[model samples]
Target chain A: MTLVLESQLPLLIVMLTLGTVAKVRTVGSGGEPGALSRLGPAVLVPGRMQAPALLVCAAGELVLAAGLLVSTHPFFRWGTVAFFAMSTYVLLELRRRRPDAGCGCFGEVSSAPVGWRSIGRTVALTGLAAVSVWSPVTGWAAAAGWVIAGPPPWYAAAGVALLALLSPEIEELIDRVRYRAPCEQRHGPAESVTLSKLRSSGTWRAHHQDLVSAEPYDSWRELCWRFFAFRNHEDDDVVFAVYLSGRRPAVRMAVVSREGSDSLPDYIPVSA
Target chain B: MGHPSVERRRVLAAAVLGRTGAVPGADPGDEEPLRAVVGEVLDVSPHLITIETPGGVQERLVIAPWATAWNGSDTTPGDLSVGSMVLMRTLRDGRVVERIWADTTRITGTILSITGKKDLTVELDCGPHRGHRSVVIPYRASGRLQVRHPQFEPGYLFDAIGIRRDGASLALLPATSQPPYPARSVPPPPPAYAGTLSRIAGTATWSDTFDEEERGAAYPMLERTDTGCPKTGVSCAGLPYLAVGSLLQVRNVCSNRSANVPVVACGCMAGRFCDRCVECDTSPRGRIAELSPSSYVELGGELIKGCFNAQIGLG
Candidate 1:
């Protein structure tokens, strides 16, 4: 059990942090943003209890996992007790909101085609968490386990948990958010009113030259960009947007205007 | 019994089952949306606003609470406050205004494109209906790109910049002002700009931190990676990953709803694919009925939902 916990340590820590972070940002955000955002809150039932309950359950697992990894007998038992106690809290919360929702105690852990014995282990572990808290002896065992293992194990666990993915990965995503498209429900339905396509290409004196000289990129890709040129009376002036996917394009930005519609300007400026 | 879009395969998922399996995370545009001034309302259950375009077209829009609704209000449409302006994705929802935020949410447009060497050149495209139009964005901006593209040609009119709104409007929490990118005027593109066209392939990497107010606007991107799933049958490599506090498109494998969330937790595989999530075995159906204040993402395909961080592809 300890070895297993140790191996899956990174994932477990990430999960707990994720849970906490998820609850924190939206904790007080009120109802979920929409049907989409509501998915997290909907399950395990709704109300304040769900987030806290999940938090406790995960935290308990985190603590228990930490103890087991160290192989500290005393701390292990105590940690087990704490984990069960926490799980009990989670299950209680779940029961309050949704009794039918099976205890998702071991997410992906229990999903993979495992053996009957594994199921038994899961049942036992869940009982430890969902049924009741641990006894005094178990608590003592966890405490002792922590002693033998020392602070190093605890610190290591903490450190590993904090760093889930590389930093560079976060920097790689460039979201190009466009609104007022002809249809939000329709995919690939962006309204791109080009100069030539708009008959407005005649006034193309080049307003976005700044972006042209921004830099000499090594690569780029056309994620998605288009100027909205709906009705001449439309209020949207969305110029084309180019997110550096792989390489830089020759004309990075373009204005969306009708053939003769100057309701705005022939071209706007691009700032690097 | 089932959705026609699903059976007809007209939806984006038609490709989901394709050879390459249409990649899941694809962002639409670059600048914040300009739309019908859906007049604002106070504390509407789902936060509604009336968007009135210059043409006097009044369309209704649903929005999230400002300040996280960490604070709520009950002001009526008649009590329109100064704190309302929506930064939205320029996509319409059936005629009902549908970008994330259309009211009071300020938005900016950042332009990026490919250069000769196959690297990405990003430019800041900003301002209202008139600020930008004549010129194309240059290849200069602060940030990095993924692997260089193969086609090292030039003169490619790749794409534009815009914003996606989470609600109809958002406020500058007095403590913080507006986003960093200010509107700038620029000269026209060199005539040769069109002559430098080329085919490029790579990724865009926007830098950010916690104070990343613009993270919601530009930091998150959909990656076009050719890399397949890991042989072990797992990969978050290609989903749309968001920066901290940015909205994430998390698709639940069990239920079909793709939850759009903030980047509370980082360090995952770019938040591309979530390998772990806290789930309840509750019936997705029952939960759906109970789940109120929802936004429907009408994709070109069917709806797939679940708890948070749901993955869309097959194992």
Candidate 2:
């Protein structure tokens, strides 16, 4: 097969290999995507586990990329280092206490990380590729392709992989713009009550007001909020979490009509 | 932020014969002067009381309008009226009598802007000079030293006296505490569109047409308004267009400090939720209120500095 065809076909085989891994979800977080348990399921998939798949894929990638090098085309060779580096980084992230679970590498295909076994697989496969590099026939062919393809395959693959790593941050920011605050609100007739609205209002304040109130937050974080409901045995009281820049001196409420201005100001939390 | 300051100030004040250093003792001298636990009032006109000193003599003497008496309740003393039982200085033809805490700060606002007709568009932050973020002393008969003073534009800083503190801000001092700064030397043109925080340091005398029909006094522009907003979103009485905690975007006319602020509570009368607090603390306002306008307010950036309208990058 042609270098491109070999490389392309192996990518599919790798996908097929990974597809066999059973996806698992941790029971604790419900279905909330907290972190790496995302990849846990797929890694623990009964049949075509991650390590084997990565092994096949990396091996395929190495062979195809080497073939490309033999054709004196160094453009795709760097993919070798990139694939391995990404595999390693993902493994590390998965092992973290706060695992970065969103390891969606296959685009709309899957988000599971290739797993720990991937290390051994990569090591074995890379060694094979290295061994092949010394063969007289293989050497000459690889040399011819490398000389013709500009630099070596490592440069191209490494560059492409590096680009892949950073693109997510840019993409994430772009996605955030879509969730802008619903401005110019007509207020929807000002609903008096609702569970959805109630929670949303408080959630919004807790997010945004967290910044205003000594709490650690910024206004943007509180996009929507719900009113907090405090129930007494007799009546349902709604108390606004009044925002103030107060120190824990005391909680006294008093009003002072400041000088030079017509504004009547009140300070809460004093010698009550 | 208090106690000592209150003590020193009280010590600097006329001596009291009966009361202890503050801890509820008799003011020091004489027949323990007269002490009454009456309801808080506005003005103690026609009569006043004298605070006794340890030396059996009354000294420094407080002015009636200058003192404030509090009512033992959750209610604010601002609700008290001149007819309310206020602690005051009994004076005979402005002579010494007694010093009592009256029911008022008597000073407010740091003047942010000034208008013609002696009306001062000030930033109401606290008592006395609390909200007057800028000083607009009546420099000339023609009002040359008013809001649009030639030598006192947005960037020009001037010295002013008689400023006081308010909630979490400062106001213009009385004609007394004026600190010194310079005028623009040349006339400063008013900003194109000013925000509430951009008010000049002079007094504003606006006649509300609403008051012409609803209330009698112009209510000092925003002297007093209802706190609990009508849930119907239909404004009729003295309530604001928006309720407390409602989000608002304020733009400083001069420096353009614009940001979305969650309505903490209502400012005296600035439109919308003009407060911008990063924390829910009462002390900042108390401290800021004690500062004089000339001592605290800067002529640059948002005329009012401590509001959350400043946190979201407005200042």
Instruction: Encode model 2's per-residue lDDT on A188-244: one tens digit a residue.
Output: 212223222323343333333322232211110011221122322232121222221
lDDT digits (tens) for residues B1-315 of candidate 1: 111111111111112112122222333433222222223232333456554433445555555344122112223333444334332322343333333332321222323332333223333223221132222222331121111111212221111122223432121211111112111211111112211222111111111112212222122121222111111111122222222222334333333333332332222121121112234232111011001112212211111111232332121
Output DockQ, candidate 1. 0.01
**CAPRI docking class of candidate 1:** incorrect
Candidate no. 1 TM-score: 0.24
Q: Write the per-residue lDDT of candidate 2 for residues B1-315, one digit (tens) a residue.
A: 112122122211111111122222212232223322212332333344333332344433333444333332223333434433233333343244333322222323333444544534333223221234432333332243233234333333332222122332122322221212221121111222212222112111111111111111111111121232211221111121333323333322233322232233223322111111232221111010111111111111111222211111111
lDDT tens digits, residue span A114-136, model 1: 22333343334443332223222
Report, to 2 decimal places, the DockQ of model 2.
0.02
Q: Please identify model 2 stretches exceeding 4 Å from their true place.
A: A1-272, B1-315
User: Considering summed lDDT, which 10 consecutive residues are worst modelled in model 2 chain A?
Assistant: A215-224
> Residue B149 CA error for candidate 2 (Å)?
14
